[model samples]
Target: MKFATAAAMLAAVLGSPVAAQNFTSAAEVRPILDMTRGSWVAIREYGGKDLVYFTHLLAWRCGLREIRYGFNGAAPNTPFKMEQCHDGAAQPNAISGDGVFVSQPGGSVKEVRVKLIYDDGTTDEARFTRDQILMR
Candidate 1:
């Protein structure tokens, strides 16, 4: 079968709305690259003891290495870290992890600082408010 035919068959069985597209030039991947250049903040980390809830850092596949995040002024260091990798292919963003930032009953989350480190040794930093994060 052809590539498109196989993709259609897979999408039909899996009910996947995400479709694939081919671009002629590499510049077409810029918009996707830009979207993944930000930080994913912690939205909700409640209702569970051993689980944590965070936002999606990257939407499209990229060579993202890891995401470093922590509270604003908690301590000397934040041990929370999220790792990203691609198995001979581009990898997605952090969808699940341990307790990176635990939500409290009365804790008012002010700002979350996040850093995105790519595989090319380049990094980007961005700050996100509570409303900026999305629930998984």
Candidate 2:
């Protein structure tokens, strides 16, 4: 208990930065992410593993420095891996794009969101509420 108390007190003294990130539209994000498009899929295992929904994209853009998944607007500096893509420069990008806030098959009680930060100091945030993946 002493250790826990000490940790808590130390944390209180050294306050952490707010995890808030700017939420933006897909069009603004796509250009920065270098992605043609992006969407939120709940439990839709791409590589396997049933976590929460993931923010997937079409034609992953290069120079994607970081991707952060935040629940209810808190961007907890979690580690994430962007999908590997090859030679995506040839593909065209979208300016006015649209996506549905799909309530995936298994619904989540809280809202979900993702932030994409590029190597050029650009950041975009997409918000969604998780739904269960429609398993086949």
Candidate 3:
């Protein structure tokens, strides 16, 4: 009887939904980073927090850059502006851009999609299932 009870209890714990929702490992996030190598992204507030959504063209690179914020979908009335930031050397870098992403609590790496608009009025958007993004 003791053995049977212990087995049942262990099985229940292992099958719980909390266990099912376990976070992704770094290996799982590698593909996302590869996909985001050079893509545009948009930053937006989700659930009272900022999240990044990927666009088609915006990409991560080092150098001079500019970006502008705009709205799409149901809420097109709001407008936002972008500022430039130098390479972490100063308040502003030549490549200043914003990104909207969804992340797990406590900085655990997770997947997110983003949309971005460039200063030249071009746009890039894409989706990532397990992409890792660092919050600002």
Candidate 4:
């Protein structure tokens, strides 16, 4: 019982940063557009496993020197990769643009770490655990 309690406490401490990620909530991202909706509006899973959808263009316009991500517990070193962002004009069902960032890792992905490095010496980051990715 004591060991279990201690382990739970440690898990809570380690998971706290995930709660502080810059990921915009679904409620907060909904007001950005009156008629259009897309994955960029919030953090989400796309396609299948090892893939996550998020936004990097709303607040800072992604005006950063570099954006990188890594899988599991590895240090973030992979360059950011995302599809082009377009409005709902062309495809009413889907919207794309810089307003979103999608990472499609090549293999089984249990966790993801993303780091956004801005030119102003500031950074925004997030990590998606497997449970969070699948549950959401």
- Return the top candidate by TM-score: 1
Ranking by TM-score: 1, 4, 2, 3
Predicted candidate 4 versus true structure: per-residue lDDT over 1-136, tens digit per residue:
9867644553454454332322233222223221222212233455653445445233422234556777779877887654432333333223345434455543466777766555455655666666655534
Which tens-of-lDDT digit does each residue in 21-106 have in candidate 2? 12133333344343322343344423343345344442233445566665555663553544443443333322223331223233
Q: For model 1, how does the per-residue alpha-carbon lDDT over 98-128 read when each residue is reduced to its tens digit?
A: 4345554433565566655565567666666
Q: How many collisions per candidate?
A: 0, 6, 34, 4
The C-alpha local distance difference test score for the whole of candidate 2 amounts to 0.43
Q: Ranking by lDDT, best first?
A: 4, 1, 2, 3
Local distance difference test, each candidate: 0.46, 0.43, 0.35, 0.46
Q: Estimate candidate 2's RMSD in Å.
A: 15.9
What lDDT does candidate 2 reach at residue 83?
Answer: 44
TM-score of every candidate: 0.48, 0.42, 0.27, 0.42
Global Cα RMSD, each model = 8.9, 15.9, 16.4, 13.3
Candidate 4 similarity to native, TM-score:
0.42
Model 4 stretches astray by more than 4 angstroms: 1-49, 56-59, 82-107
**Which pairs of residues clash in candidate 1, taking residues 3 or more apart in a chain or in different chains?**
none
Q: Over 4 Å off in model 2, which ranges?
A: 1-29, 32-41, 45-50, 53-55, 58-61, 83-109, 131-136
lDDT of 3 by residue, 1-136 (tens): 9867644554454453322321122222223334544444534445655454433232222121332333222222223233333333432223345542333333222334333333334444444432323334
Displacement of residue 1 (Cα, Å) in model 4 is: 47
In terms of lDDT, the poorest run of 10 residues in model 4 is 32-41
